[model samples]
Target chain A: MKKTKYRSQSGNAFLVAVSAVILGLIGGAVLMAAIGSNPFMGFYYLFRGGLMNIERIGNTLATATTLMLVGLSVAFAFKTGLFNIGASGQMLIGGLCATLVAHKVFLPRPLFLVVLVASALIGGALWGVIPGFLKARFNVHEVVATIMMNWIAYWSIYYFVPAYLKGPSLETESASIAISQSLRAPWLTKLFNGSYINYGFFIAIVCVIIIRFVLDKTTLGFGLKAVGSNRWCAEYAGIKVNRNVVISMMIAGGLAGLAGLTFYTGYSRNMQIGVMPAQGFDGIAVALLGASNPLGVLFSSLFFGILQSGKGFMNAMTSVPPEIADSIIAVIIYFTATSVLFQRFWDRIARRRGSRRADQREEE
Target chain B: MWSTLSSIFPYAIAYTIPLLITALGGLYSERSGVTNLGLEGLMLVGYFACAITIRLLQDTMAHSVWLLTLGLVASVVAGALFSLLHAFASINLQADQVISGTAINMLAGALTVYLARLISGSGNVRIRMGIIRKNIPFLSKIPIIGPLFFTQTYWTTWVVLAIWALSWLLLYKTSFGLRLRACGEHPSAVASAGVNVHRMRYFGVVMSGALAGLGGGVILITYSGEFHGTVAGLGFLSIAALIFGQWKPLGILGATFFFGSATTIANVSQVIPSLSVVPPVIFKIFPYVATLAALVLFSKKSAAPKASGQPF
Candidate 1:
């Protein structure tokens, strides 16, 4: 009976998630209709644009890989009850550091890759560590601190890219890294028909698996979770709450930094100024939608990636702008964030109905 | 050096107005425990709303400067309305405040861009200035402070300062102020004392939206002199200013001016022979670097409200 009850609870959570998605879709459809576009046709093109063609699918995967890393970064922090909004800044700094190492440092191809990834990880971890330290020691709010750090990261990169690393013409971007070509995997190059999908997807998948294992199997993960759920209890149990918070942020930052690798090594290959990409913020949505689980983040990140790629198809096939996808995402986040309330309401209704049925049986 | 400083003085003050206004807005929300990270989106809506109002009334209300005033009012109302969505989700629904804020930001951004396209019949909207600038006769003649603080100061500068003073007074020296701070520091304690925590938070968020809207209107009228998709990021910078200021209205004003000066210096660096030796981008990093340094320094000593990041 206990096992069955546990199964039913899990089932209920799944049903709530599904219902939230449906509600999001309905919201998107209503928005489309308001915008004078055919909702059905818009969704059709959205799917076609993101999934129908191999090239589009490759682009979707490429985007999803980066987003997955970012999502994992955020989820890792959330699991430890740390809100790491600085992911955008961390990713930017990581990308900049990796690009610098890849271009300026001379080493074997494999060594260069390892060093570049490490630099990204270190850079991001340092960025995240600031807020973690502040929160743990001084009681500073991580939300405010991380948000400030993001801006600092953005402007710092903006200056660094153009001032120090710009190409010969002194444009608003750095030159392509020297090992950029070497970083591409032959199979992925051919599979995408010369697109930028390389082995980063596999790396992201591995990272997700490792993260899942760490969160589920490791004593450290338990400590982190305990600290997240109740700092007082964790402290009483001899767990160093401060250390866990900092470690979680470091891991989160490292993951975000790895996301930068996908962009630098696989896609953009150069640092562009005045552009703060949305992957970091989108990762927040992905993490929340995935319920802050590593495996869940992978699928949600891919879903969002497909949504983004499909947005292009939506624009191509109809008068609907790609922004409809953003609207859909916003709706989904809104509903998902409120799912707990919905669950409680549903539970109350179910209980009332069961009680009424019992009363009817008693009367009989 | 004098010429370079003189040329950039007005623009510096003008640039500072938006950040100052918006930071003050953030102060209200944060003082009551709701982090107003959606300031960027609120500003976007405010910018577009003000620009559209000004444009629609251009011919009909062209003769009256009051039309611009009306535009400002409309912008603030629109911003407050936009922020109400955030307030509902974060405050009422008990959603993850940051996620709800992020969603609001995205929605605001998307809505503003879409509305701009719809109204302008193009991807950008430009507003024609109709006597938006005027010399402040007596104040304009006051020596060094004259040009820097008075002579070339836009009307919005005065408005920003007045609002800052007003907000400071309201936040620090009033019964409502105590209640609001109580709401932020310990909502349950405030509730036990018969103060409605939810109402204070709602008021805080709405006021935040209004001020942010005013900031947007100031930007449209004074600095950018137009509105475009590019104006979105300034709101984030304003949020940084709020943090750098440590959530105090007066401190935020100083932080805003500092960032504003950094921005102005970055823009005019090319004209200064000596400073021209340094890369313009380096100057651009000043505000950000300052923010980082300030955060690192303040992080060691600064204490946030006791109940911050907690859902009431």
Candidate 2:
């Protein structure tokens, strides 16, 4: 009976997420029509662009890799009641560390991969820890702290990239990493028909599994969630609230760092100095739509991945702007933020159905 | 050094006006018990609206001043309209204010650019005319103060300063202001007193949207003559200022000026020989770092409204 209740609760959450997505899609359709384009054609081309062929499928997964990691980062942070909006900055620092490793470290394949991944993890963790420490010690708001940290990272890279890793001509981006040094495996690339799918996809999957395990099976996860639900209560329960906050932030930051590693090293193969990775912001939407669950994040990110990866093609094939994808994401997040409306609606329906069933049972 | 300071003073003021107005907007929302992180997006909506209005009207209107005014009005209207979504979610739906604010930012950023691309075919709207900078006669000649404050100023700068002054009065000297402040600190008490907390919050959010839009329009007319679908994180910077200022109008004036000077210095450092010795990164990161420091200093006795992020 307990298990069934839990299943039903989870089912309710799923309905809320689905409702949000449907509303978001409808919002996108309204926008498309407002701009005088046929919404049907725009969506048709949009989906086709994402799943039309093997290369596109590979591209979709490649894009989803970064989103997956960032989504996990955000979802993990949300579990601890922290908003790690600084994921973009964390990603930059992590990608920079990973990029540096790709450029300078000439180890054997397996060892090189270890160093690359570790560099990003540590870099992201360090970035995450500062805001966490501030929140713990000074009771500072993590949202503002992370935002400041992001700009600090931004300017640091604005100078750091040009000064050190600049490509020969383009001053705006780091030098491209060689295919051998990047996250790309030759076999996988060939299998995907030369698409940018890399080992990062596998890394993201491993992280999802690990995160799920930690959240469901570990005492630390319980402590973090306890702290999240109520800091004062968590303290009363003998959990170290401050310590959990810091640790949760660290893990979240590290996940975002891995996202950077995948994005800069695995996918783009170079880091652009001025561009704040939009994936950081999109991760919030991913976390929201997924209800901040690890498996939920995985599927929602793939859904967004299709929208993002397909947007350019949709633009080329139809008059719909590629930004429609971003607009859809934004609308979805708005709906998710207002998911209380959906929750109340669903509960009313469920209660009505239960009442009807009880009446039938009484008659029998 | 004095020459360099004098040279950059006008530019610094130009930069500060937009930030000041936007931060003031944030002040209203936060003081009314709603933490608005959507200032950046709201500013963009205004910026885009102003740009589109100006682009469409510039050719037809004989007077650039009237055209600019129309553009700014459009921005204010658009920003206010856009903020209604945020107000609805937070007030009516009892949504997570931060997430709702984030959604506002993302939506404005995307929707503005999407529409801009369709209208202009370049995702950028450039205006042919801008408000020319002019020195106030006689005031410009008054010693060191004149050179720093009154010389080579855009009229929009003075106009924004007037709004800032007016806002200070409205927030501090009015009965409605007391009620609004009460709503942020203890909404139940306000409700008990027969003041509608939700209505006050809506007014605060709407005011924020209008001022932030005006701020965006100010930026378009005074310094930036184009709309590239972004205010380049100035909205966020203004938010930082709002926090740094401890949610006070007078405090915001000072904070925005400090940030404005830092930004101007960062932009011109390479050309200024003595200043060039200092790494540009220092000036670039100073405002954010200072804001963090300010947060640490204020956390124990935080002036933030008690119910700011709380849903009543």
Index of the highest-DockQ prediction: 2
Q: Pick the candidate with the highest TM-score.
A: 2
Instruction: Itemize residue pairs with steric clashes in candidate 1.
Output: none
Please give the lDDT score at residue B80 for candidate 1. Answer: 94
Q: Model 2 over residues A267-296: C-alpha lDDT tens digits?
A: 999988877788999999998888889999
Off by over 4 Å in 2: A1-11, A362-364
Docking class of 1: acceptable
Residues B1-312, candidate 2: write the lDDT tens digits.
789889999999999999999999998888888888899999999999999999988888957468988999999999898889988998899788888999999999999999999888989999987888898999999999999999999988888899989888888999999899888899999999999999999999999999999999989988999999888889999998988888899889999999999999999998898888888889888889999999999878988888887777
Error of 2 at A153 (Å): 1.2
- Superposition-based RMSD of candidate 2 using all C-alpha atoms, in angstroms: 3.1
Cα displacement (angstroms), candidate 1, residue B218, comes to 1.2
Best by lDDT: 2
B169: Cα error in model 2, Å: 0.7
What digit string (tens of lDDT, one per residue) describes model 1 on residues B1-312? 676677787888888888999888888888897877789888888888888899898888777879878888888999899889888876888766676777778777666666676666564678778325667888778887777666656787887899899888888999999899888888898999999899999999999899898888888888776878656477878877887787787778888888888887877777777667867766666666666567667755654555654678
Weakest ten-residue segment in model 2 chain A by summed lDDT: A1-10
Error of 1 at A229 (Å): 1.7
